[model samples]
Target: MAFEPLKGLRVLDLTSVVVGPVCTARLALYGAEIIKLESPEGDLMRGLGGQSPTGRHSGTYLHLNRAKRNICCNLKLPDARKIIARLLETCDIVVANMRPQALARLGLDHETVTRAYPGTIYCLITGYGLDGPYSGFPTYDSVIQAAAGIPGLVAARDGEPRYVPMVMCDHVVGEIAASSIMAALVERSNTGKGTFIEVPMFETMANFVMQEHLAQHSFVPPVGPAGDQRLLSADNRPVRTKDGWIAFTVNTDKQVQAFLDATGKGDLKADPRFATVRARADNVRAWFAL
Candidate 1:
C-alpha cells in the first residue's frame, strides 16, 4: 500500500476493449487494487491478437490488462448483482464503458453506484457525449474514425481519408479517461467526496483533434477549411528501407531545412516564399516538389 500512489485505492472495473481496460490497467499499475469485472465470455480483446506471453491470453488483452485481478461475473444473474453491489460498497472507484442501458440493467448505473456507495468515484466511458443526437448509439473505434472526418483527411491527398494505422483514438481517449479519474481521485482526497465523471471517447477524440481544424477561429482571416498544406504532401509517409519502414514527420522549418540539405536542395533556405512558417504552411506542396 505504501509503494503505490493509489495504493489504498479499491477499483471496481467493468470495462473492455482498448479505452476502459487501459484506464483501469494504468490504475492497477500504480498500486491501486483493481478488480476487473468481466462477463462469462470474458473481454472481447482476449481473442484480438493471436500471440501472447502465455497461449491463453492474447497480446491485446495482456497489454490492456496488467496488474489487475480478474473476476468473472455475469451481471444478468441476481447473485451476480448482489456480488457487484457488495464490491461497490467497499470500492473507491468504478470504471465502466458499457452502454447506459446495459449498465442500468445490471444496476451498475451512476444512480445505483452512488446510492450504494456515495463515496465511490464512478467514471463512465461512452462513445459519444452524454447529450447528443448520437448519444446512446453503440459505436466502435473504426466507426468513430469514419464519422470524425478522418477518412476525409486521408482522402485529401490523392487517397480518401483512411483509417489510422492503429487504435489511436481509442487509446488516446483511454488516456484522457485515466487522467480525469486520477484528477477526481485527488479532488476526493481533499473534499472527502467522490465525483461522477464521463469520458466519452468520440467527444474526447473530437476535442483532441479539433485543434487541427481550428483554422477559421485561430486566425484573423479564415483559411480554407482546416487543411494543413505541409501535412497535405503525398510524401508525408514513412520512408521504407530494404527491410522495414522508418516513420518520421517533417513539421518544423529546421527539420524541413535539414531534409532539404540532406537531399541536396539547400537552395530552398534562400527562397523568400518558403522561409516563413505561414509561407511554408501555405505552399508546402510546391516547396517539396521543387
Candidate 2:
C-alpha cells in the first residue's frame, strides 16, 4: 500500500494555468481527491506546450494535470454556481487562481466561500493582492518576473534585461502555495477552523529576489545600497578549468584558506581584503580577480 497522507481529503480546484493547477497536482500526488474544474472551452494550457496525438491535451497540460479528474462547467451560468455550492459542502479545500474580481463575481472569493462552508480551506492565488493599484491587473509568469525586478537582476549580470526561459515565478509561487495549504490543513486539525490564504505572485517574487539582494539597504540608514555586490558581479559564474569548467564557492575563512592553498595563492590569505567575509564583500571584484 502507498503512503497516502491526504487520502480522505477532497479538493475542488478551480484554478487554471500554472500556479493553481500545479499546487493541486502536488496535493493529488499526496492522495487528495482533486476535482479540476474547467471552463467549457477547457484550460488554455490544453493548447500550449505542443499537441498530443489526439490534439486534445497539450504536453504541458498532461504533465501538470496528472492524477486529477477534470470537469467542465460554464461559470457564467447560474446552474454552475449551484454545482459549486454543492461541491463546497463536502470539499476540504477550495483552490483558485482567478483574478479577485472574477472570483467575487462567481461567488468563490475567500469570504464568500468561507461563509458558505466554514471548514473549507480557501486558497486564492492572484497576480497581485486583492487591493491596491494592481489588484485586478492581468498577470502572467513573465509579467510577474519583470515586475518583481528579476529582469533587472539579469540586466545587472548580463547588461540586458531578459525573462528566464522557464516560468520560474509560477513554479516558485505554486510550490509555496502548496506548502502553505498543507500548513493550513495542519492548523485546522488543531483549531477545527479553516483559513483563507492569499498567495500573491508579485509580492512573493519580490520578496524572494530582494531577500538576498537587499544587502546594505536593509539597514535603517542604508549602509551602502541595495543589491549584493558579489551577486551583481559579471564574473560571478563558473570558472573555466584547464579541461572544462567548474563551479565553487569559498565562504568561510577555513574554506577560503583551503581554496587559496590549493590554488597556490596561499600568500593572498595574508591580505586584509581577503581575510574575512565582510572584507571580501567590501572588495568583491578584487577578491574575484584574485
Candidate 3:
C-alpha cells in the first residue's frame, strides 16, 4: 500500500514564502490537510519567484503550495481573530516562517499557540533562532548562503564569491523543517503531548557547511586550516571529454581504481599519492588533476 501516515491531520500553514511552504508541502504530500493562511497582499513568492501565465501563481509558488488549501486573512484587523481562532481549533499542527515579532503580534507564536492549544504541534522556521543576536533580522536565500559560508567556500575554490544560482538555503532549511515536524509528531504520539520545534536557517546551514569543511580545524588546537582541501581544489570539477563535459566523483579505493582504469590511467593506481583515500586526501590537487 502507498504510505500516507499523516492522513487526516490538519496543518495550519502560517507562512508566506519558500521555507514555510516547503515544510507544509511535504506534510501535504504525506496526506495532511494543509491550510495555507496568507495575508491580503498574498505570498511574496507569487510575484518574486518568476513570471507565471496567470500572473498570480509563479512556478515556484505553485510547486511549493501544491496539495494545500489557502485562506486570505488580514490578521491586523480585529475581525480576523475569529477566523484564526477557528482554524487553530481544527488544526493539528501549525507551521510558520514569519519573523518572531510578527507571529507574536498575531498571537501565532509558539508560546501563544501552544498555550491556547496544548495538543497542537508548532514548528517555527526562522532565519535565525529567537535567542540569537541576528534574531528577527530580514533574510533571504542569498543572505543565508553568505552568512553560512557557501559563497566563501566558492571563493576559496574559485577566488571569487558567488551566490548559488537558486534558493538552495530555503529548500534545504524547508526540508529540514519538515523532518523536524515529523519527528515532533512521532514524539507527540508517544507522549500524548505536543511539541514546539524551531528550525533556524542560518544555524542549520552553518552546521551543514562545517560538517564537511571543518576538516582538521575541528580538533581543539587547530592542526590545519578549516575547509576541505579536496573540495576547495579548483580542479575538483567537471572534466572535458571529447564529446562534451563529464562530472563524476570517485571517493572509495575501488571506485578510484575503476575510474583510473576506465580513463586509461590505471598505472596511476600504483602511485603513492593516489593509491588510497588518505593518500588522495594528502595530495588533493594532484589527484583531482587526474
Every candidate's CA RMSD: 2.8, 2.1, 1.5
Query: On residues 5-101, what C-alpha lDDT tens digit does candidate 2 reach at each position?
Result: 9999999999998988889999998999999999989999999978999999899999899999888999899998899889889999999998888
TM-score of each: 0.88, 0.90, 0.95
Native-referenced Cα lDDT, model 3 = 0.89
lDDT of each: 0.82, 0.91, 0.89
Error of 1 at 173 (Å): 1.0
* Model 3 clashes, total count: 0
Candidate 1 per-residue C-alpha lDDT over 20-131 given as tens digits, one digit per residue, 9 for 90 to 100: 9888888887789999988888888998878676666798898889889999998888999889878887899999899998889877899878876778899999988779
lDDT of 3 at 229: 89
**Best candidate, TM-score-wise?**
3
Give candidate 2 regions above 4 Å deviation: 1-3
* lDDT by residue for model 3 (139-220), tens: 8889999999899888988999999788899989999999998999899999988989999999999987885568888999
Candidate 1: clashing residue pairs, number: 5
